[model samples]
Target: MSKDEMADFLRRRRDALSPDQVPATVTHPPGRRARRTPGLRREEVAAAAGVSVSYYERLEQARAPRPSPQVLAALGTALRLTAAEREHLARLAGQVPLGTNAVREPVSADAHRLLDRLGPIPAYLVDERQDIVAWNGAAVVLIIDFGLLPAKERNAVRLALRLRDTLCSAPAGAQGEFIRQSAAQLRAAGARYPADRVLGELVNEFAAHSPDFAASWRDHDVRPLPMLRKHLRHPELGELELERQTLLLPGTDLQLVMYTPDPGSPSAAALARAETHSR
Candidate 1:
């Protein structure tokens, strides 16, 4: 086991978190002294993980024995580690049967073909970090022309958080909800792929530039990008109500996200017209 690496990982994860972000169920010590530094103190983490402060300190200092699976699990929960982060921690402690840590699986030829066959449906592909990897012609018509943007700005969360007025035409309430969900998904991704440099940079960028996004991230909510009813604006078509269907490709982090309007509805007709114009 790489004790030094594990210790560093543990310390970084602990330092990244703030006390208010900790789960409410964790009980802080009675009359605990104020912390001079940021993040949960060693004693607070130990209390949350049901361990002694000295033991956690030893783990942080790379001087402790190999942690058991149970203790690791406790530490994961205490530190609010996501599934991917927990698996990474276990692997660092010499645990076998660990899952792969791959991120941003390449979009397959088959996936590309499927998007082409979708016709007027606004469809695109997103990696775990919600970066738009590919899209169909219909997506260009209905959503923004992703091809026009630089690759770094092609991320859904980054665009939504930084350019809501320009990217989203949904009603104010729905737009807010969409931003909230996007932030939550980003938080989960940040936990799952803590070593992803680009993802970390995106988070840091928004944290500096976007107060609402930073606030939402601090909530520590994690959820899959679920099926959502969204209102999108088209320059020629005005507004269209589209229901989003997300398909997580098996054995990969790629998500096939498509927006479809209800059959026989005005939005559907509008989408057909938009599709024709694109053709």
Candidate 2:
């Protein structure tokens, strides 16, 4: 990583930590001190990470230092680094080198066929940047006018949020939360592809357009969206509830997301009807 890039990462990581997180009890009045700055003080964080305050300050200042694995571990703990963030810090420090920035090769022909075969299940393929590279028929029915989204804005998370604002006239609430969670996973993938221009642009766009996106992005939140109930309103299907599943493609920064309706629910019955019509 370039020095500027490394510096940016360090600053982000530091700003994410809190005084209480580092075992520092706030002696001063609450609101005044708490609102002073976003993250823990350098000395407090350094003490928590078992490093000298000067050394930690130097690290944050982009001064090159060969940090021992032990020190890295302590810093990781002190900063509450997620697995991806910890790995990113290592990469930035030269302890590890994230390889080339390449858009992963397109899904295999067989994988494409398999995705097609999963019709009526609402499956779609997304690259690390969350671009909707492909999708099945059922996906079309479940998501509202996804094809209508501009190519630049076709990202699953982006679509979910923008569509909510445009059509529903209210924030997507739980759906928005779910998309933000997915964006965090995408951000983690970004650490591995720091030089990817497309990925970089997507991150920048979210940071610019969406406050929720910006907030979650800062938190360094990195976790795949676990199974969750999603409420979606489809013109044809009316209102539907579905369970979402996300599967990561091996050896690539691709993800396959599929939605299945709840058993014996109105949504399931509507899905069956839509599938028949689609055929």
> Highest TM-score: which candidate?
2
TM-score (C-alpha) between model 1 and the true structure: 0.66
Model 1, position 199, has a per-residue lDDT of 74
lDDT of candidate 1 over 1-279, digit per residue (tens): 668768877887888788888765453555756578988777778888999899999999999999999999999999989876686677678764432344445788999999999999999998877889999999888768899999988987776665566656567666666666667667655555556777767777876766666766665445455778888765678878988888877887788889999999999999888898888
C-alpha TM-score for every candidate: 0.66, 0.78
In angstroms, the error of model 1 at 221 is 1.2
- For candidate 2, the clash count comes to 0
Tens digit of per-residue lDDT, candidate 2, span 205-267 = 777877888878776666556576777766667777887788887877778888888778787
What's the lDDT for candidate 1? 0.77
